[model samples]
Each structure stands twice: as C-alpha cells, then as structure tokens.
Target: MKTSTVLIVILALAVVALVARLFFFSKSTSSAASAVMENLMTRTSIRAYQDRPVEDEKVEQLLRAAMAAPTAGNRQPWKFVVIKDKQTLKAISGHFNTMKMAEHAPLAIVVCGDMDNTYPADGRDYWVEDTSAATENLLLAAHALGLGAVWCGIYPMQERVAYLKDLLGLPENIVPLNVVPVGYPAENPKPKDKWKPANIHYEKWNGGDSAVR
Candidate 1:
C-alpha cells in the first residue's frame, strides 16, 4: 500500500477510536447522572418501619454519610446521639405527637448542632444550616442502604427542645435539631409530585418556560 493511503487509513481509524471513546463515555456519564436523579426522586419519608434492628456496620455507614455533609467554614458543628434502647425510643415517640413511628423503629439518631463553637452565643451560629445538611445526608444514605427513616423535627419547638436536652443530657451549648427514626421498611410510600413550573424562573422572572407544568 502507498504511504499516503496508509496514513489516511490510520487517521480514519484514529478518528473512529476517538469518537467511539467519547460516545461510550458520554453514555456512561448519562447513565450515572440518571441513577442519581432517580435515587433522589424515589427516596421517600418512611414512617412505618419494621422491628428489625440495623446492623452496626450499616449504622456506621449512615453516620459516615452524615458527617460527609458540607458545612460553613468546615465547622461541621454537629453531634449525633444514637438511640437503640426501647424506653428512650418510646419516650421520643410519646413526646412528639406526630412521631409515633419512633416507638417500634429499631434505631433513632438525634442530630444536634453545637452552639458553643460560635461567638456571642446568640448570633447566627450557622449551626442550624450545618446540622441540617448533615441530617439530609443521613436520610439519603439510609434510603440508599435499604433502610427506612423519618425526620421528626425537634428544634424551634421550645418545649420539645428542653425535653430532648434533659432526656439526652445535652449541655447548654448543644441543640437537638431532629429525631430520625430508622429501621427496615414496613411500608413503601410514593414520592410527592413536587415539580412546580410556576415557582421556577430563569435569569429573569419572565424567562421561565411557559410550557412546563
């Protein structure tokens, strides 16, 4: 074969290889992105949990996921209290009118924010945001791990806050944010339709897609 023809064939083969590589990479990337979105969308608040307990390794994985959450200035002003005792779980269930699931759930995690890490003791400590992010990460991780969980709000409710603090022996500087009741799922609930086109806007208020619903 002529050198010119050989070079042309080599170039064509190289182009094909590059295009094929890009096509497969794009496909794999798209699949990964779709899996993530599906996981997020399908993850639902599970209130009915089985009596089976979560294993120690799984629990650790959940906590690890929570600690991975992003925090302001990397303060991570968070503390976690894991509850496995039946009596303590019952107390939490009884105290919160809406958190009855805590009674039978095999585990509960109290996500708290540390206030002493900040100045003034009363300013925007940013603890709330930091711990909130941690709590969300925990929930998502639980769902991914085939565990069921529910968020029971505790902070902002003065009486509930005081009760939990006293029950858990938390210091004045630590604040309980939420009680997460977790266990194997006993019931499966559908995720709510939360897409609201009217609530979304582009660069400007009028730039939203009108056809979205």
Candidate 2:
C-alpha cells in the first residue's frame, strides 16, 4: 500500500474509535444522571410503614450518607441517635401529635447538632444548617436504600426539644434537630410537583407581590 493511503486509513480508524468512546461515555453519563434525578424526584415523605424491621446494615448506610453531607468549613457538627427501642419510639409518638407515625416505625433516628463542635462566634449558628443538610441526606439515603423515613422537627420548639433531650439523655451541648422514623413503607404516595417558575428569579428579583404559600 502507498504510505499516504496507510496514513489516511490509520487516521480514519482513530477517529472511529474516538467517536465510539465518546458515544458510550455520553450514554453512561446520561443514564447515571437520570437515575439520581429519578431518586430525588420520586422521594416522598413516607408517613406510613410496614411492621417489618429495617436491617442493621441499611441503618448504617443511612447514617453514612447523612455524615457525607456538606458542612460549613467542614465543621461537620452533626450527631445522630439511632432509636430502635419500642418504648422510646412510643414515648416520642405519644408526645408529638404530628409524629404519631413514629410509634409504629421499626426504627427512629434523632439528628442533632453539637454546639460544642460548631464554628466560633457568629458562625456558631451554622451548626443548624450543617445538621439540616445531614438530615436531608439521611432522608435521601433511606429512600435509596428502599426504606421509608420522615423528618419530624424538634429544634426551636423548646417544649419538644426539652422532651427529647430529657428522653434521649442528650447533653446540654447536643441540640436535637429532628427525629426520623424509618421502616419498610406501607404507603406509596406520589411526589409533590413543587416546581414553580414564578418562584425563580434570574440574577435579580423580579419584584412581584406573591405571598409565600
């Protein structure tokens, strides 16, 4: 074969290989992205659960995910109390009206923020954001692990805070943020379509009188 013809054939083969690699890479990326989106969109607040218990392995994975959340300055000031005792679960459910579903849950996880582990001065309150991020991660992890869970708020409500602190024997430095009940789901509710284009502002607020819903 001619040297020029050989060079042309080699370049053509290289281009074909590059195109194939790009095509597969794009497809893989798209599929992975779609899966993550689907998980986020399909996750709903599961209030009802089955009598079945969540496995210990899944519980650890949930906590692992929670701790993997981003924190301010890497403070990671979150604390978790895993509750599997029936009496404690019942007591929590008995106290909070909105959290009655917790009584029947196979497990409950209390998300807390350790004030002692927070940032200094004005940034101290950043613990709330840090723990809240952890809580969201926990919820998402539960969904991904095929377990149902719900976030029952506790912080800011002094009465609830006091009750949980006393019940769980939490120290003064540890502030409870929320209690999450986890188990096999008994109800399959549709995810809410919370997207509102009017709520979005590009670069700057388009000043419009829209009351917060």
Candidate 3:
C-alpha cells in the first residue's frame, strides 16, 4: 500500500478503538450511578411510633448497625446517649418544636458527635457530617426492624442543645446531633415519591427533565 493509504487505515482503526472504549465506559458508569440512586431512594424516614418498647438486645443491635456507617477517615467520632426514662423523655420532648409523640415513644436515642475525637489538628470539625451519617443509619436500621423513628434536630439549636447537655450531663466535647425517638410505629405513614423530573441534570446542568425509568 502507498504511505498515504497506510496512514488513513491506521487512523481509522484508532478511531474505532476509541469509540468502543468510550461506549463501554459510559455504560459502566451509568449502571453504577443507577444502583446508587436506587439504594438512596429506597431509604425512607418514619415518625409515628407505636407504644411498644424496643427490647434491650434490639436496641444494641440497632446501635451496632448505626456505628457501622462510614465515617470521615474512619474517625468514628460519634457517641450515643440512649434515653428510656419516661420523665427525661418528657423533659426532652418539651424542647422539641412538636411534642405530641414524645409522650408515647418507648425510647429516644440522642446521637452526639465528639468534636474532640474528630479534630485532625486543622481546627476543622467533621463531627457534624460524621454524626449525621450515624444518625441516618440508626433511623434506617430502626425502620428495617419494623420500628418507627423520628429525627429531631438539636446541635445547632443552642438552647435545645444546652438543655439536653444539662439534662443528660453530656461532656463539653460532645455535640448533640439529633434525638431519634423510636418505637413500633403506631401509624404507617405512606411514603411520598419525591422524584422530580426537572431536578435531574444529565452530564451538564441543562435543567432538563429527569430520565425517570
């Protein structure tokens, strides 16, 4: 073959290889991304709890599952204050924006992140994110066990956090993330579909409709 003809043949083969690589890479990425979205969408939050008290063994299992969640750098900076006391539960309920369910919940698990344990000498606090993950795991585990749970915010609310600290005798290093009130669900709340077509963007932020499957 002439040199010019040989060059054209080589370039054509290179283009075919590049196209094949791009197609497979795109398919693999799309499959992995879809799996992640499905897992996230299946996890739902519950609030209406039944009068049944969670067993000690079950509580321990739930806590173990919660602590198993991934942490930033595996710092494991979170701590939990489990409240089964009725009077204490009532007191904490008073601080909540909505307190109707506090009277009925069998127990409350106060999720706290230790800022002291999370610090890496950079003066940055990763405790909030770490503890949030732990709290979500706790809630998910509760739901999986046929229990109901509600996440009531506490940390950033200075007054509520201070009250909980004083009530629970929490150390200065510990920052309360939220109180998860848990029990067997008294009401089975229907899960709402929060999927919005316009909220999803493909490859770029074109504000196009979500490609709902």
Candidate 4:
C-alpha cells in the first residue's frame, strides 16, 4: 500500500480505540453513581441487631462521615461520645423508655452540639441543625458499612437531656442531640418511600398548574 494510505488506516484504528475507551469510561462512571444512589435509597432504620461487634476501622469511618457534614458559618459546633461499654449501654436502654434497643447493640454514638463553640448571636440555634446533619451522615455511613443503626433522639426533651448529661458526664456547654445504636443487623426492613406530590410547591405555596411540567 502507498505510504499515505497506510497512515490513514493507522489513524482510523486509533480513532476507533479512543471511541471504545470513552464509551466504557462513561458506562463505568454511571454505574458508580447508581451504586451511591442505591445505597442511599436502600438505607433503612434498623432497630434489631445481631450479637456482633463493629470493627474499629468501621467506627472511625462512621465518625469521619459525621464530621464531614456542613456547619453554619463554619462554626462546626459538634461533639461525639462513642459508647461501647455493655453496662453503660444497658443503663441507657433502661433509663430511656424510647431507647430499649440500646440494651443489645454493641455500640452507640452520642451526637452533641457545643453551645460555647457555635455562633453566639442570631445563629445560636444553628447548632441544632448542624449536629442533626452530622447524625444523619453517621447513620448513612453505618448502613454503607453493612451495619444497622437507628437514631434515638435526646435533646429538646429536658428529662432525657439531663439524664444523658449526668450519665455520660457531658459538660454544661455540650448538648446531647441523639444516640445512634449500631451493630450487625438482625432483621432487614425496606426503606420507606416518603415522596409526596402534594407536598411539593413549585415557586410558591398553592402555585397551581404552573408547578406541573
């Protein structure tokens, strides 16, 4: 074959290879994104847990995820108390009627908001929102790690708050938000679909047909 014709043939093969590589790359990227969505959609509140312990590395990952949450004005007013002692867990379960599941779980993380470290002015209440976001992240991380967890709320309930403060030796500035019990799942439950069409408003409340597309 002529020199020009040979070069053209080589260029064509190179183009074909490049297209194939791009196609596979796009597919793999989409698959990875779908995996993340699947994890989020499948995560459910697991109250029953097996008699198994979570690994230290997984616990670290859960905390890492918790702290990665966003905070107001970067105040990041949050603290976590990791409870693994069996007696303490039992005490928690016994003390709070709503937290009976804690009696059996191997681990519980107490998410707290630090009043002294957060915004002191109008944004003072932002600590509650900040710590709540961290709690959600911790729960998702636990589910992703194949461990079960349920958020047992504490703060806002004066009795619960005071009890945990004394039990966990929390400081005056630290406020317990919730206790998350995590362990190997003893039962599997489907995630609840909370989508509601009537609850959505387009631009304003009662926006009418303009909301529909």
Candidate 4, position 195, lDDT: 69
Query: By TM-score, highest first, what's the ranking?
Result: 4, 2, 1, 3
Error at 30, model 2, angstroms: 0.4
Tell me the whole-model lDDT of each prediction, alpha carbons only: 0.89, 0.93, 0.82, 0.93
**Per-residue lDDT tens digits of candidate 3, residues 6-120?**
9999999999999999999999999989865654565565666766779998899789988998887889999999999999888877767665577678998999988778858
lDDT score at residue 179, model 4, on the 0-100 scale: 96
Question: What residue runs in model 3 are displaced by over 4 Å at the alpha carbon?
Answer: 1-44, 121-123, 207-213
Clashing residue pairs in candidate 4 are none
Q: TM-score of every model?
A: 0.84, 0.91, 0.74, 0.91
Candidate 1 residue pairs in backbone clash: none
lDDT of 4 by residue, 1-213 (tens): 999999999999999999999999999999999988988899999998999889999999999999999999888999999999999999999998889999999999999999899977888999999999999999888988999999999989999999999999999999999999999999999899986666666777664544444
Which parts of model 2 have CA positions greater than 4 angstroms off? 1-15, 209-213
